[model samples]
Structure formats: structure tokens, C-alpha cells
Target: MNICWWITILLLLHSCTPGDGMDHGIVGGHVSVPHSRPYMVYIRDSIQPNLNCDGFLVREDFVMTAAHCKNLRNPKVYLGVSDTTFLPLGIEVDSFPHPDFNNEPGNDIMLLKLKTPATLNKTVTIIDLPNLWNDKISKNCLVMGWGSTKYEDYSPSKVLRESNVTLKDLTNCIEPDVICNEDPFGPSQGDSGGPLICGDIAQGIVSFRKTQSKGNVTGYTRISQNLLWINVVMKQHKP
Candidate 1:
């Protein structure tokens, strides 16, 4: 059997044990410098206040995140947040999960259209998406979010935190559309929909992790693979 089919089977078997909803944190990461990542976005499901996810600004009126983060109600979107304790009122947005998502592992990307255009400034900016599919990804990458610093902690962190993770070989990745990493101190709970930044480009979007696996391998939806869809969605939804 080919690797892609094998990966699909493996992911299907473990689908019930996804780590996306757990109140976990970024293990072994450190607090980030205030407003260092201007593209970072904090998303909160208004209907379910405790349900939250991380996302990044990709345009003045659009934010990119994971499809699984979609909720029934429009989420509360906060930008330029370094500390959770003090946050500006969230911007209203409309959730747009990819039509192909279907609550599956693949096609796990989404875009949020802000009701009002964000004011671009020092603390709030947009991250560039990958222009092309470059299989040669940087070994060193960064993932950041507002989550606990240790696995034992259940509470999310008030301040944003970041961890340096090394990208794993794509040959071992579950599928061609994903970038995999097995960092011991990587994204967990509340970290879904965050960006996998490599060489300052938003190369991937945090999708899911194998909760039952020993390596804690996390899969990110490759941004380059979905550029056409992203562009189409953005253009179609533009005001």
C-alpha cells in the first residue's frame, strides 16, 4: 500500500483521540516578547466561552486558521494581544470553513472575514503566505500561542508563548498536504489553527496531533498547497 493510504488509515483509527480540544499548553516553551508577532490572533467561541483557538492575520480583513476551529456562532477575534488579562474588544467576523473540510483530517483550513478592516499598525499586521510549494523547508521553525507552558497545567497562559521546533522530513509525513513535526515541546490544546512559521513565511496551519502516539507528532495543513483556494475564497468574499 502507498504511504498516503497508510497514513489515512492511521489517522482514521486515531481520529477519536484528537488533541485539539484538550486544555493543553505549549510544553517547554517560553513567554514571547510583547507584540513580537503582530499577526497573531486569539479566537474565542462566543457561544462557548472556554472554547478558544489561535489564528493569524493574513490580510486586513481576513484571518487564517484551521477548519476544525469553526463554531456555530461567529467567534470573538482579538488582535495584538500579548497578555490575555488585558485585551481590546474583539472584532466581529464571519466564519468560513473550507467546503471540503467535512470534519476530516485533510482540508483542515479556514478563513475568517472581519466585519471591519483591521487598522494596520505596529502591534497588528499580516503574515505573508507561501508563494510557492517549496519542499525544502527550513529546519528551524516557530509556533506560538497563548497556552500553558507545561503539560501538567490545564489553564491557558495569560501571556503569549512561543516554542522553537525543528521540522521533520516530509518523507515521513502522513500526507503530501501536511508538514509534520515531532517536537517534544510543541503545540497542544488551544494551539490549533496557529501558524507554522518557517523562514518568516506562514508555511503551515496547525491541524491536529496524535494523542495516543509516543512522539506527539503534529500535522499542519500546508499553506502552499491551498493557495488557490485561499485566494479564491478571499476574492469571492471581499466587500
Candidate 2:
């Protein structure tokens, strides 16, 4: 099989700047600690530990990731860790990509059911879904994960990193199911499936970024649109 990660490619290349409203910051900045964003996770293909992707906890027994992930051999979830050497907490699990997720750049979302529910504590928590969000969230939110800092760097970031972003018009997105942002920085390699946080709510799932032909526009799976489907899947699969 081909060796590749799950993040998709962008067909429309464009530049994005956070002017009056945007998510602007360093291209990639290190976060305080891996656990600061308790829900963030590393999706490892145990068979090939070197190849992994990003994910986040949504429920005690469920994780959300990108459905476009490829070669997820012996998938395992490692929760809340800056350095993998520490080995915080994890669970063996099975992944279920959205039934309608046809590897399209837009519908690139997935959910995994942990064999054992995660031990939620100081360093592990579930991110609130869009439908459950409160007023604490703002228009500008954060996206954090252990992805690369630049286009040339393929290795995952040793520590978690994040950037603040604001929402842009959906008309700017190439796919109708996606939420495009007017941000100066965007998710890099290995950052797929990461959360787009608005206060306490995770409103979107990292989908893809363009290959630098234009501005820094990032795309994500609009979580609200899939609520019904998510509920259906959870009802039938939650253990």
C-alpha cells in the first residue's frame, strides 16, 4: 500500500488574511502543554508508529478524526501527551468514517469507539459539540495539535501548538460542506481531524489546506451540519 497520511488536498488555492476579522498569529506556535487542550489526541497506526495523525476526544468512549486517513493499520488512540515518551493514557479502538464520507475534501470526518472509555481527569476531557456550546465561545476560536510548523517540515511538532482563527463566508470554500476561515495560519501536516474550538465548543473538524498557490485559507468539516448523522452513528455504535 502507499505510504500517506489522511489529510486531503485543496483544489482551490487562495490567500487568507485576518484583517477586520480573522485568525492571525505565528505560522505555528507551541502551546503551553499537550494537555492544555485535553481533548487533543494522536492517532497512531501501531503497525507503523512513525506514521500517525491528529484526533480529539468527543465522548468518554469516542474520538473524532479525519475520514480521509489512509493506511491506518492497527489504529490506537494516545490521549494528551506532548512527548510520546511519557505514555499518558490511551485505548485500542475501531474507527468508523462517516458513511457518506467518500474521501472528499469536505466530508472528511470520522469517529472511533474506544475499547475502554477514556479515564477523564485533569488532563483528559471531551470537547463540547457545536450543538451543545454555550455563550462563552467567541467568533474567534483556537485550533491546536502536534502538527508541523511549516510546509517543508514533515515531522510532527514535539509539543502541541495552536492559532486563533475567525470564521469566513462559506461561499469562499470549495466544498459546500466545509467551513472556510480567513486566517493567516492554518493546520499543517499531521493536523488533520484536530478541533476548531470556539470557547468550549468544537465547531469544526480539520479537513485540508491548499498547496501554497494563494493565501492561507484553511478548511474544516462543519460539525453542525452532521449532527443528525453523528447522533445516528453514536446511537448504533456507542458501547
Local distance difference test, per candidate? Answer: 0.76, 0.69
Candidate 1 least-lDDT 10 residues: 9-18
> For residues 129-225, could you state the per-residue lDDT of candidate 2 as single tens digits?
8774222336777887666666544545566778877775655776666787756676876677888887678888887775544676678887877
Task: Report the lDDT of model 2 for residue 95.
Answer: 79
Tens-place lDDT digits, model 1, residues 1-239: 35553343222111122133223336667878899999999987666656778899999999998888875255889999988778888888988888888655667898999998899999999998888776457788999887545443345667788889988686577567877767777776667889999999898898876644466677888988888899999999876
Q: Every model's Cα RMSD, please?
A: 4.6, 7.6
Model 2: runs farther than 4 Å from truth? 1-26, 132-138
Q: What is the TM-score of each candidate against the true structure?
A: 0.86, 0.82
Relative to the true structure, candidate 1 has a C-alpha RMSD (angstroms) of 4.6
TM-score of model 1 (CA atoms)? 0.86
The number of the candidate with the highest TM-score is 1
Among these predicted structures, which one has the highest lDDT?
A: 1
Which residue ranges in model 1 land beyond 4 Å of their true spot? 1-25, 212-214
